[model samples]
Target: MSSPEHDHVATDLLAALAMGDDPAELGLDADARDHLASCPSCTDEVAALRETLELIAAGGGTTLTPPPPSVWEAVKAEIDRPAGAPAAAPAPVTSLASRRRGVPTWLATVAATVALAAGVGLGAWVVQPDEKDDATPQAQVLGEAPLASLDAAAEDRGAAVVRRADDHLVLHVEASDLGGPDGTREVWLINVDGKRMVSLGLLPVGEAGDFDFPERLLDQGYRIVDISFEPDDGNPVHSGTSLARGEIA
Candidate 1:
């Protein structure tokens, strides 16, 4: 059995790997590699995280595009604005594209991947008009899974769970081109036996959302991440029409 120290190292290694860091460059010693080779849970976690990262990176093309100067100027203006002021009207399409370009492609992709994996929006880092002090909490990534399309028509999906400082379990989900016109998409946590299940919440189409749940549910083995299409029938059960599914490591 691995000691607590080794397990901590393993977790750090997995997080680094998820961020697209080179394991060797991260100073993964021989002992750490050996532990990873022997621990099935750790191995599976690493595989899932790597797959998710690859999917995110693949979605972004190889070339890097720069944003226009106006985009930076607007962002700077917003940041420089007095606290408690109302946010200006939404920027134009060209400005939005410029804002996206302003961020380094790799950095933006990594942030989006992490945020999506953590059930947060890509705008987490964006400065808002809020005047008060804002602090970001540190979270420990527990595990992840790649959502597989149930059918050829389904789009790509991924999910990860993180343990917040307060010990809450937060699920981060990402979906692409997976929305349906019939109804909104809902998230579910199901057991391996497929008998017990719990609804986390609804997910925005083609975007990411972080849903929090009591950690005890996970302790009871509800680790399957599922997305389903639910119509406006006012029902509170699984739709039986699974769009994407993945098993958490």
Candidate 2:
């Protein structure tokens, strides 16, 4: 039917296309962009409210709020009710727009305004991390090691950590089967005076990896870490064939 002032300019252009904006270049109302371009159920309710705001932005630490003004006047009185009536209860936001129905009442009022203003759930939500950002800072560990097996009769083993994040540094590494000898495994750091080294690159075929280094390479001594094998013959050096080693401490 479309009339309470064209469903309040199509629920304020579906709340500016549910926040990721662009209510058709913000000019809005060309009859709600010609009924959202001749309505295919308002373009599948603007692609299910932009896939539920991209699953609440891939739920990374969660945050979403907008849905007040009496939940956009209960989404413009559930888009000027008419189809099958009975649904006017939702206002403090949840009750997922009074338990959905034939969809598009501006996508159950912006998915009950971002699932009850982020109290979560309705496709996915995750939360927990707020207590004033719990004073933020994490990832520190600056050193660790274990990677044995420089083959005194091979028993294999691995690990090499060295965190620090957001101030960079990284250098994870991992290994277990120790098995190798035919080509390309590389990853190094050397230079605890054993004649300098750097390579930190190819280990990934599940030998596990992380590498970032250069906080002045652990203050220029590069504390060991090795893991060579390289035999594609393009030789970038360091093929002193070590299979594992560690030192980070």
Candidate 3:
């Protein structure tokens, strides 16, 4: 029996060859090539992978219907069957061509597994509603706010953007030059009233972050984006150390 590593090398080389790649350009060692030439099992596996890739490529160019849920259930049952038990005959898959050459049982199983996965993915894509269907509205940019440093000497800067899709609203925050004391930095959605603020989450320095809040918050006048320097003193209240502030328009 071939070592697992050798099997993997041969499988990769065979896959490349099957995809119209030249054997010489694949950098396959002479010994591995010789083994592939001499080993019947390796030969069968390479052929099976080639056949599988061809079928998948053919599928990409056409609108093929996906296999039914029952087909997936049958595949799952076979995979879950206990070891040493006889495998019941597999159900016929619709698009698979009849075998051109005899392959070992293991090779057939591998090919079937590949085909089943491809079929499942294709089926999922087919069932997805088209984006242009209009029943699902595309996200719209509600507005943006440019963050400015509260201190005249600080270089802190960022922008806040609000977008809405259907009933959901998301806040996107990006920051730069946000230098502050050695404490955690957090995002916040402060109500225009200035007394009530909700902590969105932590913001790592020099990274962009997104926050999700209810549409009702915008309706309730929570349109300010504030990033504050906070000390880890087990307090949830805003620390009053604003690094940058902006009001969403």
Candidate 4:
């Protein structure tokens, strides 16, 4: 709260705490340690978090990936084709002159498309990053296991772990022989009621990132979480394959 630099320090400390690591050993220089000692809120948060992570580690190691906030409430959206819709309603092919009667000239449309392409190119050029930023992937990683697990999971198949916080859950997942792009992106969230499946973003991918669940969703009474590789091209249905799953005993 004091300074933007301190706030960045706080976030780094919190991330270390969330990962169940000793912040002192996380390459934090002297200034951060001094800042952490004086910051009571962060200290209290770290203390409580470490206890919960310890308990999670005490449980069986082999576990399933937990569901994210969007997993519950409803399944993936489906496009309902009309019950008796025709298989193919092909558009009538027409010559350029016939289409010219309907709207602006082809030259105008080409100019517009060229303008759009130039705009996109300029946007990308403006956002180019330095080496560190370039090294960081822009994609979201669904699980929160430490980087060590990620390095190991690269070669090992069927290794996934799930951990529970006081009001949220974290998943660590990895696999090799999974499935399709869209279907594989889908995952199943199995609770006592039934299955509230979810998509784990992508499969066989890891960067040791973490995801947080909504407190309200945890109160809804769903416990176990499982994920699968689902393709993202279209269909929003579960892949019916469980890459990894976990639940408390």
Top-TM-score candidate index: 3
Candidate 2 has an lDDT of 0.63
Could you tell which candidate, 2 or 3, scores higher by lDDT?
A: 3
Give the alpha carbon lDDT tens digit for every residue of 1-249 in model 3: 344334433333444555566554565556556666776655665665565555655664434344666666656776787877755643222221231223344444534553343332122213222244355665799879888888776454979899995667898999877777888989999999988989889886565888888889988998999999999998998999988988999
TM-score of each: 0.43, 0.30, 0.45, 0.28
lDDT at residue 34 of model 4 (Cα atoms): 67
Q: Write the per-residue lDDT of candidate 1 for residues 68-141, one digit (tens) a residue.
A: 45444555565566777754652111111221222345444443333223322222233223332445546777
Worst 10 residues of 1 by lDDT: 91-100
lDDT, candidate 2, residue 123? Answer: 30
All models: lDDT?
A: 0.62, 0.63, 0.66, 0.40
Task: Give the count of colliding residue pairs in each prediction.
Answer: 2, 0, 0, 19
Ranking by lDDT: 3, 2, 1, 4
After TM-score superposition, the amount by which residue 57's alpha carbon in candidate 3 deviates from its true location, in angstroms, is 14
- TM for candidate 2 is 0.30
Candidate 2 Cα outliers beyond 4 Å, as residue runs: 1-41, 44-46, 53-146, 165-217, 220-222, 225-244, 247-249
lDDT per residue (tens digit) for residues 145-228 in model 4:
211112335333344445565555655544344433444343334555664643434443542324445534445544455555
Question: By the TM-score metric, which is better: model 3 or model 4?
Answer: 3
Clashes of 2: 0
